[model samples]
Target chain A: MRRLRLVIPAALALAAALALPAGAPAPAEARVGGRPPPFVLPAAAGGPTSAPFRMGDHLGQRPVAILFWATWCQPCQQELPFYESLYQRYREQGLRVVAISMDSQATIMRAGPNARRLNVTFDVVTDVDTRVTTQLNPRRAAPFSIWVDRAGRIVREQEGFSPAEQNAVAQGIAELVGR
Target chain B: MDLRRERRGAPRRRLAAPALLALVVLGASAARAQSDLSFELPGVGRTTFSLTSTTTLRYRGENYDANRFDDDFGSLYQRFDVALQADELRAEARIDLFVPHTVLVESRCVGRPLGVDDPSCYLDWDLRPERLTLRWEPSEWVVEAGDTQLVLGRGVALAFRKVDLLAVDNALRGGHVRYQGSNFRFGAHGGLANPQNIDPIDLRIVREPQDVVVGGNMAVVAPAPLGVTLGVHALRVGFEDVDSIDGVTRSRFTDRAVDVAGWSAEAAGLADGQLALYFEANGLRRTQRLVDQARSETGRGVYASAQLQLTELTILVEWKDYTNFLVAPETTEANARRIYSAAPPVEYDGPQRLRGIGNQRGGAIRMDYAFLPGPWSFSVNSALYAFNEEPHRDPFEGVLVSHSWMTLAKRQEYGGDLNWSLDLQGGARFETLLHDHDARFRSGDIDRWMIHGRLDITVGSGDHAFDFIVDHRHEREIRGDVAEFQIGGASVTYTFGIPFTLTLSLRWTDYQPGVVVSRGRREYNFLGGEFYPSLEVRWTFEPGTYLSLFAGQTPGGQLCSGGVCRDVPTFEGFQLTFVGRL
Candidate 1:
């Protein structure tokens, strides 16, 4: 009986809260066919040693692939070598890859070592504060990928990694690079 | 009979009205296709608002054999998160609601004086605004007020943040400011520790202590030629002493204070990014104020690591030492909270509850070599730990432990028609207790071995995939009981394209140290020849949204994430989980 009294009021409050944002205009996010938000973060490994990474500098210069990963995520660990292979294959054809680590302060110290151990040679940066992640991968999914064309527009996005998606991801990159 | 009639009649009517109203409101909102809202404010800037919600509905049809609670009960847990960003300003808030609140049967009510029917065991209903924060960042400066996450100097001094995997989110409710430059960085923060009191999964409410904290850090980087950086940090915390008397909470301010001061130095990008080095050391002072006297104790810690990366080989070595050093230890079981500071544990990321951190020394080394051709790699690691012999103060004193593991992995694709991968790993752990505490006590040495393997095979260009996993552990503990145990599990997952996945898993265990046998009493028993089986189905509605259903039983144990560990309760029920953005 006491539980029922509490549920009724709580349910009504939730309904009211849910309806408050219904009338507002639709907003844009970092998704396919849109321009991704810019970011700057500390470089944990690779690319211009001891320097911070700014996304604007490489936006329109060449085709780019952005990979979001973490040290504790097993899937991320499995998927990194694949991205490393992709970077190695397309580096000479005006392709650039940036791997952003979403490891917090507790585990951020291992990001560099993990990236090194995985044989990743691309630019790796750390989002210790998660400010960039909030704007890009709001759901905090690991092994997320975003492909951008030379014109700085996002062409494709994937939430999780599977061995089956390797060819598709490679094909997307090949198209951007005009292979 | 009259009381029962009133309870069933009035509450049912009240519940139905709001439920109907909610459905109507939700239906009206669902007509829109967008999940986020955006608009421009005059004289201000472009503003955007987004909401994310996760709801879980659970029904327990069967209870554990020794549990006192009856089955056939339902519960709901929901979280609503809202964020707004306008140019350089941002605001965020979150609200959590639970109906007919539930507590962890194993942890909270198994052998305690409270029962499920007791109000002290579970709240009838709960709703709380868990987080609220505002921030402004312009150019090279950031100012945040309300709730904040802060860390200093490799987290040995002070660090507090949200660790979702462990269901631990503790923030500081005050203010913070920082400035970043090309070669210099500075920051400072001060606030009262605001640990989340509600367990999202169990919907249990716990009391939190109000600890006051203040900290700061500064760093300067040398030019390109030097490639070196130096920094310093300091932190102080006043942990309030809290006690419960006759169901009421009380606190004393003049109890204890902890202070840590530290410095760090790092050399990175040396030898053209091939070599990197880091070192940090801290000194701690803890002062206790008694009714008649005040006493103080001193401790210190050091952590260092070195890394070498080359085209085909990578090596990393780490070392850490501490003596009587722990920040804001859980003084009592009732007020269990995450420690304010977390140092790196130089062991494998599993089962850290038994690894002592207050007084210990350890080092680990790992090497990875890509010696084979075409998408194959091998790696090996070894670690050793030793603890001081403090017979009067420590329980697991003079203990020595060692761990070693090796893994081989491969990933291959054949003509874009098929893809496959394999990962095989095996490890062994040994522990020796030097001193004998007593024959009746369960204090002894341990020998354990484990092996894990995973295989993933995908066919037909991202259309279908299958995953198989197997894990086995064998252990022998030489204690008064002299127990020998084994645990094994296997699972298979089938994914149908990009929308759905099905997984079937089974686990068997013969290791039993904490299983209860009698209802309403703490009777010891062994769980021999027990099996737990479960099935799950997941569907993806869109990017950043999903629905999942799970049924059957789960065998829970120690789960570690982000350097924190917690015990999860076993479940025998059906669950539906939904995550959506709007």
Candidate 2:
């Protein structure tokens, strides 16, 4: 075990010498292939509603997009509006969008008003209970977005969203749904 | 007042008989019987009233003249708090009474306790029934609509959940409802809190109260090995004229308010071998509106901690990161005081690294070991904190320090603390300020030496216990300001046949100067010592009733925990506490 530990560091050092510069640009998002875990959560802003909320439910029916957001988070405020516009543009075709809120029940009591004031029109659910989060410890952290194809498999997972990232999400959804 | 004193003293004698007889049978029985309670109320069918109150007085003072006139002078500060709750009237299915007063007394700006002939005093109080309320809890679900506390978690997110038993000062005051089940627990509370009341200045009137809503913690604890804690907190707090100082009436633009929302998830696993591992994460978002500037700022902060224990060793690590999008070009000052209450303002902007240095990165690593063979069980701990400019999310707060030792005190044991190094700091700036000519911290930049000592102390049953220590330290940073400090202290405690025990302690610090401070530097005898004699008397009048009186004096110094430390004020006074359960 000791020899292996020493060997690994030496191998890594050699690899670093051949690798790109330390300041190299971050890698572009690539096509991811894997089955997503299933989940069922309370719907957003409506009566206790549950659409086959699990990941497996949309496997063969439609292309699925899931976005994790919180009420007080500033980044989500800027990102969710963009998702809503894309959902509007593509919902009729075959794309299905699900917005998951990480806010606790206490926060939702106040954020519910803000969402209405902002005119958010989409399907939202609360992850406040940690039913789905503790299981999938996403690397990029919260405010993450994932796109799945009709075959019940994941295609992309973005840690944070910029205009470009959102556009990419829209294009991916369009391709999967339009197919 | 005299009759009330007589009534109180009368119970002391009434409770002493069964207590002494039970003590002869077993000491544990004496304490346990007094703590049992039915947790029932006398109302509804019956008619009765009860009044409960708790008072605490704490005073501390410190003095240090190592170098004179350099912000290192001795000081004194104290706080005396008194709180009372009364259940005044009860009839039918309800009881009505009001808590109308709270008093706090303080004495600030004392250079030293020993030199002062008299201490300055200040008082603050409030007597308002509007700040009070009434409630009824007839079952496992208690719904209280008044000033109360809701404490939960391991003190990470919702640290102070339960109302202070002594202070009775509730943090989240509003309507509180709690539900307790055999396998589950739930609580939800919402109300208005004056964050400014955290440190009330008026002492007479509550000010700057804001809107608050928090759900009590819900947790499930299995028989063993597996448990989880979950909680959600939210608040919309607005300061009353926090931004506008002119005291003018204006639009909502002049209102400074912040909406804060947070959630946390914690899980733990415990197995055999006395080992456990737990992880928790908390996230908070705060949005503030500066009415005068007509601008709103928003920020987010997150923290995560993981702790693990195996056999006799334990390790813990935590990370925190916060950023402000409202402040265009963010600096330390804006983030320190404005963004977070615990963080001190910074002078520059850098990556919130893991370690101590700014615009740099830092983190801390600790390892602990324990022994369990003889009458002694000791643990050795070492921690390292690193700083670099990495823009890391979580930053380390201070320098790296370590200690290795073994000791047996009280606990009916005998052992000795081996050689241990309290600190080994090596940053250029830190080395210069802390080691070179730093008389504020006693003697610095002196010779480094080993600390060898043994402390064997016993209580409750034993003739007498004695503890003593001697240490030597050397300095490398202060080559020109070479010096040495030899410190030694001893303590002896004696227990009497009755319910009274007395303890005596003495400490001395001797300095040997190697460098000159002035042109014609004359060696001065810097003798600092403390004589502490404490007497504790435990008097039990009857079941669930007792009075405790303890009086003593302790030396003042910079008390350090983990790798950080704050000066501990010198203390010389007596404290009497009474605890009753009925």
Candidate 3:
């Protein structure tokens, strides 16, 4: 049959040039537990705001973290001030660090005072309705990172945030606020 | 006004509000239940009646090339159907009665049997009704009609997402009105354009004209970028002039009264991601003693398409041009102003529209990409065409440009051909489903080289499923006319949940034959199988009924769609079907 059709496309082009193998792999690490999907934002400082911040309304209950930025994402603006220096080094070891802002309030009120001049204390939420980045994190891109656990349940989701994952999320928030 | 007392005063005015809400919910559930008198709640209304009938028996036989052991016979077909439906508020109306019979039962065991039976037995009849508009909106300014699909965007709902695939043609009538918000809406109707008749009465029901096209559609609320639409379409036509059977004059012998006048203009800032730029021009030019003489087939055309995203790719462009346009001719031109004296001058056939690209007059481009992120998608398209060539525009229009007798010529083998394509799709999922994968790759050329592939599999509680398809084709011809060929096919289908679905297909072809001593042979062998069974009933029905059986062998080809194509007559047959829904 015409020499088996000229040797089967020359043996499938030498098996696709020996499977052109090399490079481009590795990139999806951080994974601890689950339950971090709660949101309700309508506040850039206005009203509706009951989001990933309700660990029974603060009293020293700290230990949040969130982060999930975007503005056409440039690596989420070079990792938003290390989440504002990990909330000013665990704010008296309570650690809150919010920074949500998924843009669009005409681009986050023009970048929220350069993110409050990187002063870095805590409250700065505005997910302009990406439904809080797919509700806290359902693999919804954009430099994500979670960590709740003051019993809000979401002990680690992280996607682009390494410094050894910010020292394993500041050593698990100093072992859950024990300092 | 005694049309049976207005159809019995329409169920006595809907039995005066569900019989006054069934006597105030059966007198307060019979004063808070004193021993079940049957009147439950939470919502349920039942009133249905049905009657169905079907009978199909086909026998066709054929045998060609019978010599010595000359005995080949196979061809047969038959059909019978009956249906009825009734409802009372749980509204529904169906009446399908078809009596289709084509039987040449065992043509002397197999000498002739192909189409309409050479010996006689062909009966066809149809009547349908499943919805004669019975609607109720109660509030938002009222809507109460029966048997309807009277839609006019922004409200009223007889949807196809408001005119992207228009539909409204069924027969049987009703009337109603009301809507005072969302910018007012109203309706009125008679019937016969649609009352559930699935388009297909051969030759357009002997060339249209039974009149009954009274229209209504209004959505006027101008501002923020202009809008004006006014409509009127009328047809009471009955023009006949058919002859052909080699006797000529097969069309164009008139009669009158076909009215149509339309005006449409929509605007939304010309440039900058434009999205609505419309202009409509229609003229029927036939009022009283009908005088269209196909009026050189009057035509009008203007089109525009735009989509630009800028960041992260999205660009689409479109253009269209029209001409005398009035098409419908698959054989029926017995000298319509001299079609080469009633055919046969080698039958000159070319220019039907975009086939392997040639004779196109308009162009466009499209590009889309999302690239990696939630299962990738990519698209790359290119199209450019400008047609009409008779030795570069006019050599006395030699039969639409030297058609395949001069061997071929549209500027030497159909010029102006450029069709490019590229498409890629990707998918992945594993572990949570053991295995899930999707892959696609496509490439194109002006002449041809169309390839395709598919692979899927799922076992266990996934309810056993498997998929496979590999297609390869090659067609390139222009002058040197070596007529290349290569076709490969494979299809496997299986479904265990939807009652039944079994498909098996295999194809292979390698030829160069145009009969120059059978130039490089091996052209016959196309295997096939089709078995689909689905007929289960409950509530909600409309175009939903099936009984299919098929057997096949194919070597015959060429069948296109939308752009119209035909060249299919070569087969080994066995087909049985019964479908009804609504």
Scored by lDDT, the top model is: 1
lDDT of 2 by residue, B304-343 (tens): 4444544344454444343431111122222111211221
Which tens-of-lDDT digit does each residue in A1-179 have in candidate 1?
34454554465456435533334322112333444544567788433234767776777678888889987665676577777787788899888888898887545656775676566778889876565665455556788877777866555555776554455556666777883
User: Each candidate: what lDDT?
Assistant: 0.63, 0.35, 0.32
TM-score of 2: 0.42
TM-score of chain A, predicted model 1, versus the true chain A, to 2 decimals: 0.78
Residue-wise C-alpha lDDT for candidate 3, range B113-150, written one tens digit per residue: 32223312111222233333343433343343454433
Worst 10 residues of 3 chain A by lDDT: A24-33
Residue-level lDDT of model 1, residues B1-582, one tens digit each, is 122122224455456445534533443242232433557877657666655666666765444434444344566666666667665677777766665423222223334333223533432344567667787777677788877767677677776755566666667878888887768888888888876655533464444567898888899988886778899999889877655411234444356888999999988788888888889999989887667587788788788888786766778788888766777633222222547776776776654344456567888888877643456778798888776535124423667777888878665434456666666777777776756656644345443334333333333345567777777777676552536666678888887654567889887665444432221131221233256678999765544445679997666555565335566555667787666554
Query: Cα deviation in Å at residue B406, candidate 1?
Result: 0.8
lDDT of 3 by residue, A1-179 (tens): 12222322332233222221133211121222333323323223211121224323542255576777653343354345546555565677666656676653223322333233222336666654242353243224467656565644444444443222233344555665552
CAPRI verdict (incorrect, acceptable, medium, high) for model 2? incorrect
Identify the candidate with maximal TM-score.
1
Clashing pairs in 1: none
What's the best-to-worst order under TM-score?
Answer: 1, 2, 3
Strongest candidate by DockQ: 1
